[model samples]
Target: MKLQPNLLLRLGFRQNARLRHFTGVGTSLVYREYGDPQKVIVRREDVIPKLKDDQVLVRMLAAPVNPADINTVQGVYAVKPQLPSVPGNEGVGEVVEVGKNIESELQPGNYVIPRVNAFGTWRTHVVTTSSEIIKIPSDVDIAMAATIAVNPGTAYRMLKDFSPLNSGDTVIQNGANSAVGQAVIQIAATLGVKTINVVRDRPAISVLKEHLTKLGATVVVTENELRKSEEVKSLPQPKLALNCVSGQSGTEILRKLSPHGVMVTYGGMSRQPVTVPVGAFIFNNVTLRGFWMTHWNKEHFSHPKRHQMLNELFQLAKTGGLQPPNHSLVPFSDYHIALKNAMPREGMLCKKQILIF
Candidate 1:
């Protein structure tokens, strides 16, 4: 049958549509040396990034400025990239070009989120293996997708890995107001498990409680409340404790767990050691385990499983159940100003900040 050439163009589409493309022709953000957050050198210029045959080129749509990302740029993070390297840890993008072999797995126009620690996600484009970019649901919020790769994934893994907690089981975590903590609360709630959340005192305690409670936290207490509340002492002990705050604050989280409970420490934001009573480990059979998202992502999951996990996370995001408290969305042009405002803040004001092109 003979086809009419203009037929497709007439079906609500423009025939000569142009998509903005990026190449190594000019510089994106790169660090020559690490110093201060404000002064850690970054240069913008054009230099072609080599791509593997199994890789794809992504036009970055949006990226979040995570604490880890900032730390890496400051050269204080655990995993440091080579000098003069790009320094973004996570971002969402649309695949613009795909290599031959990965054609079945990825294609142009697919939305994806790159794995955390695969730095350079902050650029106008990222070249990465097909296996590294997790295809996200297109209808999912780009801002949410940009922030999902790390906190939500980490929380999912920690809950599943750190011991089996069935419905009705209780878990406690300090720093429960953190992104991961909020995710943990909602995910656990969806699984029918309960959460006891602990947070540092913020300006508006009642408002904070309402927020976490709505996210399915059964109990939300300030550190001070946790330290002295007789009501909390009478409550049922948690089977697991997730600690991000360290030092004495973390130890207090341990005190709320039942005997034989496991405490998984994923972050040490407090810069203090997690001190537990010697008896908690020796007599109570409490276990303290460490979890690093990078190490777990590397050692535990297969490529296919990792991809499936990402799909599940996006499904959660689609329902509006999983989300970071969005602080702001900055365009690619205002990246400098956005980066400047990305400092650690307090209360709800300290929520996640996403950089959107």
Candidate 2:
């Protein structure tokens, strides 16, 4: 007297409210077409099919709503998934079941995260190939694990790859209030590197400055202050400049770079092109570059550096050296609330939103 898969899922959804453990059914925020996430993404529940020989069943614990996730849903990001896709780029989950033929060391109860981008992490459960996910240290905070692979990884790599920064070296950057910027401050502090953090002015500028300063920013200044402040002018010119906000902000940081310094542009929060002065390149020999974590992962798929970076970040989390960005945890059932808070609005400082399953 075996029941059908759909019927089994229906029963599981009705009977198991806590979701403390996997029950062969899960919900997902799926978008059938490219549009605004709020207008297109909908929650749906379905049966969890049995695993293939190479697949593993993961009970998702938590996932963050990153800006990239929103851009991917709107069909504007560099990486677009096929329509009718789930939208999530990073998350942490627990292994609930493993296919019998799995040859790797993965087993039930191990915590894992997708090794590749666009793995559809905004779901309650996932069945993915063994190679698609990688195990992470189980002791780290779930929120930190859920958010680590993107922002912190970006900060770490930009510091290491673009230049040979040693202790006491200075790095300057715009968008200091962003998650990646905060990570840069903390990671740089650990290495004894100094950071000049530039952020937009707000009504509560003092509070923002305090927050970033606590995170290890040597100095926090607004865009206008970056231009007029004698303090900024007096410090040693940075060898590395990190630009996430382009337009005038980008040029401001570039002007502060030392001769033969490097500037890495990873994002354009202002949606404006980066403007560089001719003298900065010709006279100063400054270099301009870009970094995309997804592309880096693709190029270094099996590189040992990837594992080393992850382990170092995990250690930082355990020791409180790296902290999860300011965030709000919204229950997975209240996904609409999370979306509303996460969506960008004029003059609004949105906290990172993590969905707890």
Candidate 3:
């Protein structure tokens, strides 16, 4: 067929690669320096980038206000974005235009999420390579899609990579109310693995326990309970422990691990170091390791296993093996509320604040 000028305008969702078109530009939450998000990030309207031969243009639909995204802006995260960069690190976007010679399935209107870190996903649009965007089912929830890369992937990897778990094996983790913790409960339930989830003691504790129970947490306990409750002693020795709240929450969960089991530390939500009894190291023979999804992605970007794992996670969401995180949407223009909501207030912080552009 003869090629038409500006082909991107004619294609519904499968626009031909040769048609280059522009949707003008977009607004981005940009920061020129590392500082508080409220002080560093500002509204900036800029021209959308022209597509390069190997690139595809994506229109961002939604991006979540994750703590890591905030920490990166504050210069606290281990991975910092170069100055004068956008702040979002993970989100869901749609292909709106593509380079004339781009060779991939990322045609106009296709749904995709960034396949790599530091792609600056917190904006209205982005110009990224076809190979850097992971294709997702077009019909998936945009909010769920935006938030998937970090939490679910971390939970999935921690569940599978750190230890060898069988159908009946037990796993223990702290921060059971966190996004990753919720994911761990659901994913473990799907795999028939039992989970003993530990959360902080708080008012209306039963409400939180009921919520996690619905997601299939085999047992939900408070820090005090995990440490001293007789109920905790009745369960089998957990073969694996996942720790994100690295203080007392981690300490108690680590003590419950079966001898020779592994404890994987992924975060320090409490801003405290992980400490265990000397006896744990000397007598229990427990192994301690850490996982960073960013490092893992850097190592596996080109590997088929990366794609396979992402695909499996998406499939799990599609089939209800997972439930989307509790999220409150904020318009791109009104991002102040999003930032405020993302912060811990009155000691509660599990709800996600998402930016919808």
lDDT of each: 0.76, 0.88, 0.84
Over 4 Å off in model 3, which ranges?
1-20
TM-score of each: 0.87, 0.93, 0.92
Model 1, runs deviating above 4 Å: 1-27, 41-43, 47-54, 230-234, 346-348
Model 2 reaches what TM-score against the true structure?
0.93
Q: What does the lDDT come to for candidate 2?
A: 0.88
Q: Sorted by lDDT, highest first, which candidate order results? A: 2, 3, 1
Greater-TM-score candidate between 2 and 3:
2
Clashing pairs in 2: none
Question: What lDDT tens digits, residue by residue, belong to model 3 across residues 1-80?
Answer: 12234543343224334554564657788899998888878988877655677778887888898888888898999988
Residue 280's lDDT within candidate 1 is 88
Ranking by TM-score: 2, 3, 1
lDDT, candidate 2, 1-357, per-residue tens: 122346445646332334323345688999999888899999888788766777888878899999989889889999988878989999999887677788658987789998988999889889898888989988888899999999999999999999999898899999989899999999999999999999888888998999999998998999989978887777788999999998889999999999999999999999999999999989999999999999999897768999999999999999999999999989999988888899886554569999987
lDDT of 1 at 78: 93
Tens digits of per-residue lDDT, candidate 1, 187-294, equal 888888888888888778888889888888888888888867765665577898899988888998898889999999988988888888998878899988999888
Residue pairs in clash, model 1: 25-46, 26-45, 26-46, 27-45, 27-46, 247-273
